[model samples]
Target: MTNNMTLGQRFLANEWSALAVAILVGLVVLASMSPAFLTEFNLYVMLRSFCVVLIVAFAQMLTLAVGHMNLSVGALGGLVAIAVGGMMEKWGFPVPVAVLAGLAIGAAGGLINGLLTVRTGINGFIITLATASAFTGINLGITESIPFYNLPAGFVAFGTGRLYALPYLLLPPVLIALALAFFLARTVPGRQLLAVGGNPHAAELSGIPRDRVIVMAHTLSGLLAGAAAILAVAQLGSAQPSIGVDWLLMSFAAPIIGGAALTGGHISVAATALAVVLIVIIQNGMVLAKVDPYWVQFLLGALILAAVGLNRLRAVRAGGA
Candidate 1:
């Protein structure tokens, strides 16, 4: 059976190949349509934008791996951004200390979400939704809807620095993606996470500790959210209350478009990264074409629906095959 597949058939059957083709086509078309599309500065801008969103998508992807959803991803990110900002500006903390504290805060928030869901036996959707509101409330209460200006100049420089078309901000996400891929494919806990997501009863029967895996996923989600928030602060040169305001859409879109199963137990780090690349291309193309920014939001909404439909169709086909 394995020897019978033709090269073309195998390429078509591999999920990421389609996205790779789409991206190549998009790059060619956009470059032809707009001369500025391939310019070094524009390339840097697109790569910079890709960094934080990739992490945010990873945050959601981890939770999705366990058949759970995290409505609080954006809210928790917003909270962490301000908390880190305040640590730096108000408390006079250094960058490393502030960043570590922010990550810890994110982990703590995720811990709360996981514990509540596990202990109460509530749907994660409901648990995260409720916590989303709570996180937002705390964010608003802390800053009074204000932003933090005057971050360290060195941090800001790292955010905007680039070599040719490669952004310095690109490094962390690349390392993270590699680490995540390795974890999911090679590590025991990571494999256990997918197992729990794939079949809770079977995993439990196998002594895989289903509850522990769910909690771990949520905690990792929160940690990624924190990383994203820090990146956002660096990119903008300030910590704004609106940092994670629009992350909800992109977070879900990237992973789903990249072929993650909402049913859990399936994901691909490389595919998700490519999906982010495709999204960035679309956005950059729209900007070059001078389309209204609001249309970008509408397009994202439409893309989500299309991706979901495509996933359903693929699942049906796979089941039949």
Candidate 2:
């Protein structure tokens, strides 16, 4: 489609292109400033760290696509982490069984969120906020704020092992991103999801099940969140109550920066992937520059605002054109 366009036109038309350029620029700058930046060890570390964040972002992105928010993403993730951890460490469950149970729990949590929103006709923001508290309460009640150690050896190894600069952890997100892109662009249910988000009334008139799609989106969001939590457990070699404490911000940040509209019905898997890369680069650069870790929150907040403003401006210009 872009073959006939000029380079500038291509850049303007494809959101991911701009993100790719930004990532490239960030990589060059960081590599120059810190000799350690491009080393195999640092590269592996960055890749592994991004794996969980990318999945978490995708989880939130699904909810946003349905014109809703999932404030409970982090809380749900923390719950899943501990649940899976307890299953493995205390219940003598196998890894696969524990992982499946954790995902089921996440889906159930999401189901509650969906049913409440649909039944009560309350805004999703409110529904998710209330659920967030509920999820957190459950987590705290079960774990007592303690972490679960003694994860399986193979799982921990997969989280940390790498070939050259590529961590084994990188595989899941890559496959997931590709599958998501395909699903959104090509699948029937996927189209229905976006169609409902694009115009709920119109979709209903066209015989699409609006409530079902929203519920499905929420359920998928929870499943992905569960996957991310499990991965974090493997990476840390423990299931900490704090596993998802900081995910709320980054989960929203990457997808929004990737050009997902707050109003819904628009998202780009490729663009979101690039946005995650750019964010990871920025974080690594800060570490190399000896910046205070606390500043990351401020920076991410600022970046989100900037991205929203930029997107609004672009919309205005496009409308004008």
Candidate 3:
């Protein structure tokens, strides 16, 4: 009965309900496939692991809401994580200082994307794809093929500690994402940002300062990615340069597969969270079922194809009807 409701109404009622259903179903299937999957320990492991991806996905989803994509997110995230670790190891900087450094790097990364998109008049794909290369190069430059380790004590607390049976580290990403969602949904600037992304020309005509929104949106994405980098470092206890590379694909996959569109104008933070969890479950199930990582990639590709096909068909049918 709920599934039959209009999407608009459903979105208003529970943006993440569909994703929650998917995750639950995935969990059940995985549990049935393997008896060991139901333990609280496994739950903790999965949640902890999924946090970084969820953080990145939320950042990506922000750009998607306004008709942009940040291909450099993974690289930037990795770079920041590495930076945090490097600072702690070499300079003995406090966790807060290192974390701030990471955030600064992220914000700058986002600002670059924004400037390029607006100034060059290039499509998002071209701008971000090029920026991704640069970000990767920056990573190589900073780490120089060696990873840094042994971050400060405070950094370790958020990632490895548990709070009331939940990962204490879950606090950062969850809070950041929720704050971002509220901003996008309830704030005036956020609305303008959405409007600009949804229909830039129209927004410009209506005096929305579309260019400013582009910069601001990209900056927000960058900040979130930076925060995610800190979380990654805290959780892993080291700043691995390659930590966020896999996230490039996973981050976008979460929201788009969950229900967000590529063409912009739609944003659902809650739904995006559920979407990311579902992805984590799929990976978890594959691991529990002893499936190869290669097969998981193929499965993800197949699901994405199916989702795109279904959506395109729905759009066509709606137009005709």
Candidate 4:
């Protein structure tokens, strides 16, 4: 395999490659460091742990694929969580109905973001960053600084219950990531998406709908975030104003480390899924290792920077260095 492949292209180009090895290595390290780490009970938690991150990772990957970044993903996710909780609790909506409302809020928010970015020509970073504050404030206001609690059983089952020993909600993110991978690599829209990302000028000249594409991207981002929020409520059995704060940071990091270009263009959804697993593994191992609590973010940041640098170096070489 080494003889047939360049270093940077190795993982992204092949499914059974370095990233697989990394996952295995991470598992081995975790198992060795903590005897309890590999049990079914803990594995369920690990899968659940990665679920939210995987959702946001896909959301960020989509935005970045279209040459943009959505800083509001975490905030928006929280907003949806609060919306679902408040709707069910205060507004007297049924659990399923409240969930639908949550999805509606997320989709509507994304539409506004997409329209604003497409129409106004503002930088996406600035737009989503502003939205983030707004979302956070709205979340705080909706909850009245108090957390929503004691979610119904139907909601909790999503995160806590299992089918044949697998967490129900956990399976969906994996399925989503796989479906996204197939879409991007094997579909017409997928290729068009890459063309739009790789060179918008050329894609526009070739008749691709640039504005529509971006809007769709943001819309999907919102959907994914909303779904994740619903799951968050399921897992926590409640909602909090700060529910999405930590995830906002980790979501962006996962895709970048998973082989997404920072400015958007090329990426692998399957790779992103693997990246989420790696992150979960790291976090789990950290807890088992009992290392300094503050070191986790530092470690993830450093890993992301390293991965991006490696990808860039490969791109440069492959482009004829």
Top TM-score hit: 1
Q: What TM-score do all the candidates reach, one by one?
A: 0.97, 0.96, 0.91, 0.92
In candidate 3, what are the lDDT values of residues 86-173, reduced to their tens digit?
A: 8889998887787888899999999999888988889877898888888888888978868786666666776788854479877777
lDDT of 4 by residue, 125-150 (tens): 99999988998899888677788886
Tens-digit lDDT track of model 1 for 74-151: 999999999999999899899999999999999989989998999899999999999999999999999999999988
Clashes of each: 0, 0, 1, 0
Off by over 4 Å in 1: 1-9
lDDT of 4: 0.82
Give the 10-residue window scoring lowest on summed lDDT in candidate 3. Answer: 9-18
What ordering of candidates by lDDT runs from best to worst? 1, 2, 4, 3
lDDT of 4 at 203: 92
Report every candidate's CA lDDT.
Answer: 0.91, 0.88, 0.81, 0.82
Q: Model 4: residues >4 Å from true position, as ranges?
A: 1-16, 163-165, 186-188
Q: Better model by lDDT, 2 or 3?
A: 2
Model 3 per-residue lDDT at 176: 82
Kindly indicate the candidate among 1 and 3 with the higher TM-score: 1
Clash pairs of candidate 3?
66-197
